[model samples]
Target chain A: MAEVEISQLHKTYPGGGRPATRDVSLTVADGEFMVLLGPSGCGKTTLLRMIAGLELPDRGSVRIGGRDVTYRAPRERNLSMVFQSYAVFPHKKVADNIGFGLAMRKADRAVIQDKIAWAAGLLQLEDYLDRYPSQLSGGQRQRVAVARAIVMEPDVLLMDEPLSNLDALLRLQFRAELKKLLTDLGTTCVYVTHDQVEALSLGERVAVMKDGEIVQCGPPMEVYDSPASEFIGGFIGSPPMNFLDATLRRDGGEAVIEVAGQRSAAPGSWAAFAEGPVRIGVRAETITAHRAERSGALRAVTEVAEPLGSTTLVTAVLGEQRIKVQVPPDFPVGAGDDLWLDLRADRLSCYERDTGRVLVSDR
Target chain B: MTAAGTAAPDRAAAPDAGVDRAPLARRRRNRMLVQVACLAITAFMAAPMYLITLAAFSTRESLNAFPKSFAPADVSTETLRSFLGATGVVPSFLNSLVVGLLTLVLSVAIGTPAGYALARHVFAGRDAYQLFLLFTRALPIVVLSVPLARFFITAGLSDTVLAVALLHTALALPTTVLITASIFTAVPRDLEEAALVFGCTRASAFRQVVAPLALPGIAAASLFTFVLSWNEVLGAAVLTLTNRTLPAQVLGSLQWSPLPYRFAGGFALLVPALIFIFVMRRYLLNMWGTTLR
Candidate 1:
């Protein structure tokens, strides 16, 4: 395994109006599982391809294991990649596909056979060694692709949305196995995916990207619990974080904010922004709901309730703004039912209205 | 009011179901008539081949009799032996085989890489070049043979099998390029890229992964080019005088041959093409049956 360093990387197609990736830089430590996550066309895959030497950058350099490899061919880079299409050779048997890299490197025949056997055993593909790729299912083909990359035992492994083609159940099952496998091998990896769940589960450090730039990069929980920007807040969560416009005000020596004509004391960090317009971001799970009417709570009528077994998600409207609140599934609620939602002060994040950057917190 | 108005039509239409049977029967009869017409046309096109084979195998007496019998009276080797023993006939047949094989090699060797580039790369004037290939199809071989004959004479290549083969390559190249390009396009690009990432150079990737997958398409194109060159008459006749392809020699000497020899020559000329198709049928099936997925 080796550390990878990229600096000031930029790439643009010949006739593209905008660069696919611009001024991007990142460092992945040895054996680190760094995931590049964003929506489609967000340049995550482009950055990963640049690191793999499959794509050349317009400007900037990449260094792996302290050696500059910006202009090296993909084969000379000694890096392996699992394509999103699971590009295992359809004409080759599974064992040959897994041993292809080894054969290219002129490995001993015994060693190639041994490695193929180990990979097939690890992937539970022992019975399929002699079968061509066309005979395998989608999940099996993806496993073959992984086996092909891992058998090389390269210093770095790159995966681009490898699980995106599998069905949801298979994706979930394979992702856990893949996470275990990567950890076992301890190979430095750069994975690109648009799936938030996969990013959260698979990445040791998640780099949230947008418009060819990194918006946030940190441990998954840190980036999740404390997103750096409104875009990160919305992109990282399921039933994403809710945002509401409010103006800070002073009431009886304390800072307060009003929502749907109901006023509540704001966190003390907002004292400087009294009478300033700010956007509040609250996670759906952080919002508490009470069946009985309570004081200092925003009154709303439930518009939709989705029961997800243990926790029910309730989407409701307070005045003109809509908010999603996750409550206990056992809590009785229906469409048009009046419910009171309490936004926890500690769980709320405030951002400047126009800039969308997080408001400074004193803690 | 609209619901009540629509309900009345449903009751009125219930008794009209029997009226549909007559049209259905008529449609079935019409389909049967079309099938019979197709069968008749197929038989009409196929009958000449059957009659020619019968005549080629019949005894001279049976063939020349006043009452011409359509059936093969008796299987005889005398007529075939006479044609095979004719001076220069066997040599012409060998020349046809040599020209066909040479043309197949030249066309594929030059066309495969051009087809690959057309299928894979984006270069300036690529679309225009492809259109030009298609446009060449409109030019007749007779028009090209005249200029080719002049060039061959000046180069001292006239009356040689190589001369005929070269002309045939020019005739077959456009079809070869278009067919091989489409075939190469069907082989996925990702497989080659995958090989490259697995420690192969670009050339090795194509040799190891792509060529094997595209073999069926290549085989089909080879068979097609061979048959085309084997059967071409105008270019073969114009380019060669002494070293004639079988078709050219047979047509040139048609008046001098006896009736049995003419029939035998016609049947003999078809033998190699039939053998080529028989040998290549499997590859053709693979090419058109299941697409590369």
Candidate 2:
């Protein structure tokens, strides 16, 4: 197993348009589960295809395990991939599908059998070895596809949304299984997925890509909490971070943000940005019900209350703006009634509304 | 819907209504009438063939009889041997086999690649290239055969099996290409991509992955080309006189020639079709599916 380094890769299609994957650079450490997460057409799959050597880059080099394999063919790269469509050979039995690569190298019959058995057993696909892909269910076909790639035991395992076809419950369950299997195998994997939750749960480090470039890359929680920019803050969460326009000021040893109807105290970091109207982002869970008349804060009238059993989602209107809050399930708030939103100044991230950048000190 | 469109399916479906659960007598009679009509048409085609076969095997007296025997009432190998002894019937049969096999090989070699390209590749002249193939296939062989034969004779290739095979390959090229193109299109693009990612080169992926999967189709296409070559008389007759293919040999024979040769020649033609059709039986669904599409 070895780390894969894609340095300044540019993949311009032969038709001569914008590069599908631009000057993108990211590393998948040895035995690291690195997820390339982005929406469709964001170049995640293109990058993975380049790593697998199925697609060639117009510029830059790809080093796998310290060896430059940029111009090499996929077979020479010693990488196996499980495609999003679960590319199991429809005509072949599950055993045949898993044993195909081994057969290609003309491995010993006993060795091929052992490898097929081992891979099939790991995937819980022993009973279906004799069955064709058309005879198997969606999840079962996907498992066979995974088993086929894993049987090769390549230096790197590339997966392109291998669980996207399964139904909701199956997807979640198989995703957990997939993570465990990858971890147990100790294979370095570069996975591409669009689902943020899947990325968070599967990757040791998630690289968020946009427009053929890596916008942010960090551990799941670090990227979730300390978002580097407005895009990161906007993209990381479920309902997404809510942003409201407010003028910043420092009055008597306290940083304050004054909206149209109320004035709220800010975190200490907001002092450097005490200028004109800026965007303040609050996580849905950050704005809790502040009914006790707590000092050094502001209040907003709750416009809509969505109680989601374990937590309540309250979209409180701050004059012309809307700020979402994830409060305790038992928060005393309802629609049309005024509710207090106690946004802790620390959790409220400030951004330049005009430029859409983080309004924080360099430190 | 227009009256014509509405009535079309109803007219098509009317005959089959007899198979309805507990079909009424009138419906069954209508169905029987349609079946009888179909049977009559089949007989219309097969009757001459049956008569020819009977006249071929029978003595001269049988040829001048009132009506022909439907079955091989007095089947004999005597006429077979006499036909085999006729002006180089054995060599002509072998020549036909050689030409047919050659045609099948060349057409498949050229057509399958063109088919795969047309199916998968998007090139600058792709549509125009396809239109070219369409026009080439639609060109009547009658307009080209005499000139082509003359060209072959001048080139010192006339009356050779190679000349006939080349001519047959040209005739069968478009049909073979179109057949295999439809076949390859049914295969998914993702499968090929997956194979590529697994380290197979484009050609290897095609050979090891796609070609095996498309075997049924390719085989069918080759068989079709083979049949076209075997059955073609016009080009084969003109292109090769000495090493005449079976159809050329049969057509070269005089109208009043021994009836036995007609029976044997017709029987020889029937053999390849029987074999070719049997070979395609497994892929009947494939042909049907293509038709549906």
- Which sections of candidate 2 miss by over 4 Å? A290-298, A330-333, B1-91, B254-271, B281-293
lDDT by residue (A48-151, candidate 1, tens digit) is: 88887778999999999999999888898888999999999988999999999999999999999999999988899999999999899999999999999999
Q: Categorize the docking of model 1.
A: medium
TM-score of each: 0.91, 0.84
Candidate 1 vs. true structure, TM-score: 0.91
Each model's interface RMSD (Å)? Answer: 0.9, 1.6
Candidate 2 residue-wise lDDT, A1-363, digit = tens = 889999999998778677788898888899999999888888999999899887889899999999999989888888899999998888789899899887876789999999999998999999999998989999999999899899888999999998888899999999999999999999999999998889889999999888888888999887777666778778778888888888888887668898875788888766766567888877887776776666655667778889889988888777888878888888788888776767777777788878777766854
lDDT of 2 at A264: 86
Please estimate how well model 1 matches the true structure, expressed as its whole-model Cα lDDT. Answer: 0.88
Against the unseen true structure, what C-alpha lDDT does each candidate score? Answer: 0.88, 0.83
Report clash pairs, candidate 2.
A75-B199, A284-A326
Worst 10 residues of 2 chain B by lDDT: B1-10
Task: Write the residue-wise lDDT of candidate 2 on B36-80 in tens digits.
Answer: 788799999877767666666776565557676666666677776
Q: What is the TM-score of chain A alone in each candidate?
A: 0.96, 0.95
